[model samples]
Target chain A: MNKKRIAIDMDDVMTDAIGRFIELYQQEFQEDLSDLRLPGRNLTNTVPPERLEAIKQYPHQPNFFKDLEPIAGSLEVVEQLHQRYEIFITTAALEFEHSFTPKYNWLKKHLPFITWKNIVFCGDKSIIRADYLLDDLDRNLKTFTGTGLLFTAPHNAHVTGYTRLNNWQEVAAYFLH
Target chain B: MNKKRIAIDMDDVMTDAIGRFIELYQQEFQEDLSDLRLPGRNLTNTVPPERLEAIKQYPHQPNFFKDLEPIAGSLEVVEQLHQRYEIFITTAALEFEHSFTPKYNWLKKHLPFITWKNIVFCGDKSIIRADYLLDDLDRNLKTFTGTGLLFTAPHNAHVTGYTRLNNWQEVAAYFLH
Candidate 1:
């Protein structure tokens, strides 16, 4: 039997993208984000209106995606999942043209087991064909043909109705078990 | 009504990849390829076995894919098809790691209408979701779930199972008419 394919989103699903954005915000404004409240369904909404424009520009910076810390337990869980299913690290990299090389290199450095052949850099997730998609964005999930397993993230906290995986451990239990 | 999506291959379908390789081979080896016999199925088989390794390394060189001339009439035909169908310029770029930027840049420069969102840089075409896939490689077509429209090239001249389109004009007639 053919292995079931799972299309994995890179940003908030695998990498802690909002966490990186928060770090970039703190460094740029010289302010701690700990005091701020986490806004539901949109991380940028938590920041001051004036700073939102600047924070959005972070992805355009060189190496912005290069050093992103993977979500807690993602590496180990994804590594195990790789053996059981076809995992494609699909990301919406077109919006930030500069992120292409850095994101590709980051995957090469971090997930050395996932070969270049399985890494996909595209904009729309609707074109992806897989048995399942683990993504944080509800919009992406809404468009996908496969079963959408909403990976829990602050920006996607408001999303409901789809199966949610709070963390990589949950992801493991959902699939591996 | 939703427009039918067409996942188009980039190398031989949109760009003249083999033609560019032949040009590079002539320039590097200081030998004209005009006298060489055209092999039925594989373009590389036409070249001397001793030069195949060096010829394969051409894509690894910077800007090898950037300056490739688009296949004859592809620009006009695809542009017309774009208005009718959801066209995605999908290329197998993972094999050529350095090609990510160049291929993206090439599309921006040439097919500016096909935005970055519609462009996909992937390895296996089997993961693509579309109503129709127009590709030059028989292998890519064989794996695609949708209707595979074989785009004719010297390398695929011998392949005969699927519908063959000889040129861009033929592609236009097939889709538009």
Candidate 2:
């Protein structure tokens, strides 16, 4: 039987990217950035409008995209969902040249069941065709024609529209049921 | 500049699948199959009709898709072309699950630069949006809205409508020029 494809984004969705960024900022300034807030409160939106370039440079960091920890229960839920549907890790990476292998290696290590063929490294998510997309950024989901689930993130907490998923277990229950 | 993507088929375009199939058929019946002509011939249209079921079993055989040798000069030309265009290995593999990893490993070994993200193992080519597609069958290219170059194969040799490429040299010259 042909299975419906569920495309999942990497940053802030599967990977605990916000946690890492907050931790990184805390280490640099020696201050608590966990309470840091954004003006628009979108994960994709940078604070003060000046740190956008700096935020883009994080992927270029040695292990920024590589060493990110997966959200709690994400790996287990992914494995469970993999048995029932075709799960694709559809991520946008055209902006980062050095992020290719690091992200590839991270998926290989963390989500070994997802074959390299199922992983898509794309620039624009608009060209991608899938049944559902789990992402934190509204930009990708806004343009996506499929069912876009706004996976919960720090900044996206204030944003609305489309279904919201607080965690991986919720995603599993939604798709599996 | 966003370069045009050139999607190439895996079976006959990259690997010598036609040569292997003809050789396998010749060895099985201990007779000449090379003299067999094709205009209405397809990858599934095995002569005598009795071999049709057996032809479908080829993908299940271990190393069937893995062990095929690369076409002469295909690799070198691909290397040269990789510098000029965004090359993707667009292959149809839903009919054969065992073929996925083998094809992936083959490309990794043979064409390391073409990352897993660029390689697409798809069933239907209709949704694929590439600037150009180099394929062995008319069914794939016929649905493609982009320019299609039918790479020469025993099954597709007699078919017409799209542009035909006899070898990798022609492909490089067409795209590189």
Task: Report the number of the highest-lDDT candidate.
Answer: 1
Clash pairs, candidate 1, are none
Report the lDDT tens digits of candidate 2 across residue range B1-177.
887878888887889766666677777877665544454456465456778677657667666787679988789998898898878777765346456567777888999888755776555565456788899888888878789999987677678899999888898889888
Which candidate wins on DockQ? Answer: 1
DockQ of 1: 0.84
Local accuracy of candidate 2 as per-residue lDDT tens digits, A1-177? 688878888887878777777777667656555554443353245444665566546666766776788888888898898999878887765345455556677888999888765776655565456788899888888867789999887677777888999888899789888
Question: Which segments of candidate 1 are over 4 A away from where they belong?
Answer: A34-43, B34-43
Model number 1 iRMSD: 0.9
Global Cα lDDT for candidate 2: 0.74
lDDT of 1 by residue, A83-169 (tens): 999999898988788888878888988899988778888888899999999998898899999899998877777888899998899
C-alpha TM-score for every candidate: 0.95, 0.57
